[model samples]
Target: MAAPIYKVAIVGRANVGKSTLFNRLISEKKAIISDIAGTTRDRNYAVCHWRDLEFYLIDTGGMGEKSKDIINQQVSTQAIQAMAEADLILFVVDVRVGATTEDRILAKSVNRHKTPKILVINKVDNNRWRQNNDDFYRLGLENQALVSAANGVGTGDLLDQVVTALKKIKKKKSKKNGEENIRTIKVSVVGRPNVGKSSLINTILGEPRLIVSDQPHTTRDSQEIIITHNKNKIILVDTAGIRRCSKKSGDDFEKMAVEQSLENVWRSDITILVTDVSEPLTWQDKHIIDEVIQQHNGLIILANKWDLVKNKDTKEYTNYYREFFGFARWAPIVFTSTVKKLKIGELLDLLVLIYQEKHRVITDNALSKLLADTIRRHKPTKGAGTKHPYIYNLKQTRTNPPEFMIKINFKAILHESYLKFIENNMRYKFGFIGVPIKIRVAKSQNLQDK
Candidate 1:
């Protein structure tokens, strides 16, 4: 089992740069940063790896005596949960505006919980406001507020303080709850609306944890449920139904939900494309698969409602998979009915197998030799084939959407089909099932073409 990750909560009112701070600290724009208040409705979180330490940074909803939207309720609940689960809480504040009546209420709430918090004053763009943060001491968090987050002013010292706080509060061992030696695989159940996606998850989990109905797009946020199979943990993330981008229209709430589901897929290690056998592959199904490809997450296609398929075939089933999604020819396809719970355990086994393949790494010696033989068998017809078409080094630049950077000795451009051939060969040999691969060619002289 992987170690229990530390959680850092960013709690503050909406538009207080909580998301900005989370993005800045992680050195990546994982969260959507916008001028609009309540852009992040829930406690948006992303795991950050720093040196030997790994921790999750959470962005909470803005707190106040008043929040009207249904999304705000979700965010507030998530923020409260974050505080309860945090190894450390960074209470973000806006130093430029100082403190307001709402800020006072939020501060009192934090004080009531008595969670160890670091008062972080944000938007202190200049020394004037940087010095003004001292006034925020009245919030009762005497630790002092740091003027930071946007433009990263006073961030270096803030990070040092954060690391020091983390060291003090972080647990040295994994959660004993995982007392068994088992691997937990995060599986995302994804598909178009009204495809029984939520029903499938609630069925596997043996309860109606997810609010399931006949309504299309019933699930708004990605909800999680854990199931253990022979001591191995399987995390089920039941995502909202994915719709075609072209189909996506107004209703701001719906857009946010779809975005959240996509974000969930990005975090998950493997995704199960749930579809109705009656409908087979639709444009929306292809859209979700494209996203999974882009994210480089593992894929499994579940032809749901198999019980309803009157002409279920033994041979043509594979044909449908190949003809429909040419990209995921190697992905495992399971046919079952969530209503009947048929072959659900088999699906679980296949999910674990797909997850294992996702983490499989190719040895340098093996990959190098394979690349050579593949190129030889299907020699890339070089553009202006003079000069023996120089080759440089081969490096696997990315995984989880397996990609490689092939440094060519010549600056000549290579054919797209040739790159596709190389990618297909890598997939055929390595069993990169349900994942898309990219091959980028660059000119290099110093690097060896290993």
Candidate 2:
């Protein structure tokens, strides 16, 4: 049996290099690093291994003076939650800015958690800056490490301290049999600004892991969290809200964020595209759908904010969306209200179902039978030439965006409509309800000879 991964949270005030420190510790650019304060509104998580010890590293939004704004309050709440769950806390402070009243107040809050903490004085790039590190000692934390996260200086000493601290804490044994083999599905929740994507993820997690606000673009970085539900491991990714490229061109930060959001869809196994029920489907939504389909990624459409809709007839809305988004007919649609917590559990169930279907494979014999029956029912029309395209063999080449290869007669050009017909037949015969399938054609050796 393996031991549980100890959790270490990097927490501090906004713009104090928390995200930079997180990226440094994980040795990856998983979190977005920006000079703007409050750039990271959600708690981003990753696993870090130091000196043979594996631990979970969490990067939380800055915590400081409380504000009445819902987003600020939510961010503070999430930081506190991370502090409570962590076995140790990395209290980060900026050396150049020095410690302020907010740092003192935040220090007091960290002390209340009763968790062991190490003060990390960041941005101390050279010996001159190292002298100023003593100024942060006024915060009253005993242990301290100096480092410049941006340039990766003095991080080794910081990690050594972390490892030494972890050695004292006892860890529980993990079940060895089949536990390490559990498959984790990466589900990326994406949509336009203010579409309740973060709210929906918080509802499923049953915690305010992300900051929710009425303002658009509240979340700027892609946050990844792992949760176990019904013995299934799921990696839920909450990405930055995507805005139109034209609207984002003026701001380089926003442009980068939008690009990162699109990249998340490409990297994920499945994408949950959230849309507002009150608003009509727009060109941006269609553009995102096209990207998902073009990437050959599995997709699920979620009509969020359903409670705001006055119409109780969901069937009518469903029919309208079906017609409006006919291009994504393979994607299943679900109505949800993140505020009301309606069908949130059902959403997770559907996520698991679709993930399973995405990796489903069809037997060669079954695929052959299905192809024969489909051709007999509706024969394909002739293409540019006089001879019609005759499929000689069909076999599934791979799964996860299931790809199939078909050997056909030479010079038999299959029309786009004919390919769609074949795909429809494949979907109807095999239950690939919420996944995209790719079909390829090749000329048979015998047909090539002719």
Candidate 3:
């Protein structure tokens, strides 16, 4: 049967980056950009054919955007309208700030909608960094797809997961097949109430464009400003601080702000998980990290307020995840003090490096030779005390996490420790400096039969 066209709406609290993702999805239809109704129906928003799914993209602003201080009311109305018409709603949340009463309110409201929804934990570039978000699970979303819309970082996986979710709910969609031209890094600074996330963002921007005050939850709604550094233009998202539930109405904007922050993460390639150096990594920090990993985005840990720490060990912060998430062995780490703005330039430089690492690749001969040598030296140990055979003749097929297809004996599992050794060997022979390596294993065909 021919597939029915499905509507996909990017909606969340105001400034949660629905517009940015919308522009990214329908960038080719520049002529149709409007404030009110480019995609209330199936005809608008040019689409991309992903796997077997066809999707029509729509965008909606937070409810009651008209009353907001900064955001345009008309645009907000469009966003709200788009969400109601969408088959699936991408609920974005900020991990650093944790969950707010506003989020619960939105969750309550969204739950009543009967629409298949996927909560996207955005601004999660680092899995090690989390501040708050687990409280959001009560929203009734069992599985959430994580993605960084900025670098296209787990976006493919997020899309795949979202589609899977959509299939289960039977909220089918069909989008017009076309090329999408969305490029630029959209970064949203979000964290626990008064965690200095805004101060850190303002510090990096070197501007007071985003308001900062001693007051908690000062900034409401998501505000974006674009700046160019190192020849790269990036969109900076300033969000209201997320806090525990307060007055019903007050919580609404703040929780919505958190949602917007999450959307910003989903729309961004990388996220700077801003945290106070002195404070312990709380549930909020952990929640933020969980969301970032969920989205597959790259993360850089920024220990803000470093000036407050007296003679602390830098190595601990640098190697925080060496024992935790083994996969983050190569994730870049940096320390910064918003008060002193120390190492700010170096941090940004590291960002460019982190962005570049995903694209690094080594030649095939070197990979194969290294793979063969590593396997021969430390043979794989299978379960039940069997030492499996080796992998030989590896060839580089792609870049970005540096994938390599290797011929190996399928009898054994590739041990993480052994994998690290091979990676070290590769880095030594051919400098991978900032990039992470991805190794693929394949079985050798029958020799005698051939």
Local distance difference test, each candidate = 0.75, 0.86, 0.60
TM-score: model 3 vs. ground truth: 0.53
- Please count the clashing residue pairs in each candidate, in the order shown: 6, 0, 35
lDDT of 3 by residue, 1-450 (tens): 233467676656643444544554444322112233222111124354567776766545454313554334444444556567777877766555555666666666667767788787665556552334566687677667554444444566767876676667653344423313222455656667677776776787776444455656655545555566676656666655554455556444455667767776776656667777777766666677667666656577667787787877888865664444345555555567788889888876766665665566667666667766766777654433364645556677776445666565555455666656777777677755444466666665556311
Flag the better candidate by lDDT, 1 or 2.
2
- Give the candidates in order of TM-score, highest first: 2, 1, 3
Candidate structures ordered by lDDT, highest first: 2, 1, 3
Q: In candidate 3, where is summed lDDT lowest over 10 consecutive residues?
A: 35-44
For TM-score, candidate 1 versus 3, the one ahead is: 1
Task: Provide the TM-score for each candidate, comma-separated.
Answer: 0.60, 0.94, 0.53
Clashing pairs in 2: none
**Best-fitting candidate, measured by lDDT?**
2
Cα displacement (Å) at residue 361, model 3 = 2.0
**RMSD versus native structure for model 2:** 2.2
True-structure lDDT of candidate 2: 0.86
Off by over 4 Å in 2: 1-4, 247-249, 447-450
